[model samples]
Target: MKTARAMRGAAARRSGRRGEVLAALWLMAKGYRILGFRLRTPQAEIDLLAIRGRTLAVVEVKRRTDLLTALETVSLDQRERLRRAAAAVAAQRPALAGASVRLDLMALAPGRLPMHIPDAWKGA
Candidate 1:
């Protein structure tokens, strides 16, 4: 039973990753240049890093049964972590450092179209 549950969880994570990739591609179509996926720093992991003109976007992707749950997944601590990660990424890429940074959330729930919340949170 434990093995079955683990497998299910892994499958769900993979599915969510796929959904995020699709969403990233959709953003690309809208002129967002994808910088990285699953970028990990000492502080945190950002699901997607994208750029549009002079704006740098750090995206968090959540797959849940409902939008509220997905939105809730990104807690205050997680937001701070993402902020640190974005800063680290910017430090590594000087061009991006001068760009305005924003946090974004992409939620994908079954039977519903994906929802993107730009500037989802401002780190305190």
Candidate 2:
């Protein structure tokens, strides 16, 4: 039998994956093409990478009780990490070389449609 902590960890991972899938579908509905999911680079792990027109979106998915809480959860350090990860990924793919990067957030709450906030933060 799994320990309590292990069970919680597994549940969290499941929730995260669900949130990411919802976020990807939401992005696609908005005309963005998903480039990757849970992409791990040397800089950080990106939840989702998408492109629409000339913009490349580095999306972070949050499953929370409230949108405000989800939005507040991304710290400055996390934002910087996402930016760095985006840079690393972009460099690796010629298709993304000239695209502009936008840090985005997809907030998911129970019974509510996914809330996508484009340009969610300006990285420092």
Candidate 3:
């Protein structure tokens, strides 16, 4: 039998994946093309990568009881990590080199539409 902690971890992973899917769909509806999903880089794993016009969006999907809580969950360190991951990915993809990277957050809550916050953090 799985331990309680293990079960909780599994459930959290499932919820995170579900949030990512919802975020991706929401972005698509808003005219963004998703370039990567659950993209793993040396620094961190980016939940989603999207591009529209001259901007490349690095998105972090967060699910919580409310939008405020979800928004508060991302730490400064996590933001730095996301930036690093974006940089690493950009370095490897020539097509993305010239695109301006924008860090975004997709906040999901129960019984509400996903909230997409563009330029969620200023790039370092």
Task: Point out the higher-scoring one by TM-score: 2 or 3.
Answer: 2
Give a tens-digit lDDT track for model 1, residues 1-124. 4698899999988997898798798788879999999998999988999999998999999888887787788899888889888988998997886888899988888788778878877544
Per-residue error (Å), model 2, residue 15: 1.1
Going through the candidates in the order shown, the clash numbers are 0, 0, 0
Candidate 2 wrong stretches, greater than 4 Å: none
Clashing pairs for model 3 are: none
Off by over 4 Å in 3: none
Report the Cα lDDT for candidate 1: 0.87
Ranked by TM-score, the better of candidates 1 and 2 is 2
The C-alpha lDDT values of all candidates are 0.87, 0.92, 0.90
| lDDT for each residue of candidate 2 in 48-108, tens digit (9 for 90 to 100) | 9999999999999999999889989998888888899999899989988799999999999
- List, residue by residue over 1-124, the lDDT tens digit for candidate 3: 9999999999999999888998999999999999999998888999999999989999999988786787778888888898889988988999887888888989988898889999876653
Best by lDDT: 2
- RMSD to native for every prediction? 1.9, 1.2, 1.5
